[model samples]
Target: MAVERFPVEASHIMMFARSVGDPNPIYHDEDYAKGAEPGGIIAPPTFVQASSQYDPDAALRPKPGQPWFGSGREPSGTPRGGGGGGGGTGLHAEQHFEYHRHLHPGDVLSAKTRPGKSWEREGRRAGKLKFSETITEYFDQNGELVITARSVGVQTERVVEQA
Candidate 1:
């Protein structure tokens, strides 16, 4: 997978804040943000993670007859998707983040995402399953690393039995 970077404009931060229902003045009011504890208008922690902006056409998908291309099957038996079911199961297993500094308007942001690790394991009911871990790094216009995020998703061939 290739890494994608996006510029962070004030509009993006404000739109994200509104979409997430965060009413903090700092996220909306420039004056209030400048006076806040952080010293400048900053995006909410969750806002940073929500900025997974990417080109819709640039997403990775399997080609035709490519062993279930887009079917969420990696050589292993893991399912990948938000549904958490066999053949098409995927879920956000976990998320970890680290922030070196807050992002402000006009800060060009770029992200590089790649497969970090993957494996298969036995599920209590589904028998065996596969999962993949991905790491995405965000950098500022200056090429300075600003944030790092790791996301995990489970891919299986069977429906994910509810716990």
Candidate 2:
């Protein structure tokens, strides 16, 4: 997904840090961060995770009633796993982030996502489960890579009855 721009605000950074229970002053306190290396306030390492939301296209946010990758099945109605919408059967197996440069407030960022890897494994209870990874790379206005994030999502058949 391509976005023209994603202006990063200090408030957004501070809120995200707070939401994640990160009390690091570098993310929220300007005076405190100014003395730190890099000389200014920097966003949290995972702040770029929300870059997808800046896209005009609904890359991450599906329309109402639309199925998402985490919906436990393909949009074509083929079940990806045993889960038939009984409950939350998806799992975030892993997450990784590589910061090539510090993200400062007021920097306009854009991101692109690509399919990373996929595999299947036997589940102790759900029988079989599928895992897929996606890589998103965020770049700044200067066309420099600021962050690369990899997220692994796992889906399995629902073991419980749907309401």
lDDT of 1 by residue, 33-143 (tens): 778897777877865565545433343444354443333445643343355444445556788888988888777777888888998888785556677898988888899
Task: Provide TM-scores for the models.
Answer: 0.72, 0.75
lDDT of 1 at 30: 81
What range of 10 consecutive residues in model 2 has the weakest lDDT sum?
A: 71-80
Model 2 C-alpha lDDT per residue in residues 100-120, reported as the tens digit of each score: 887899899887789998999
Candidate 2 local lDDT, residue 158: 51
lDDT of each: 0.71, 0.79
- Residue 117 in candidate 2 has what lDDT? 89
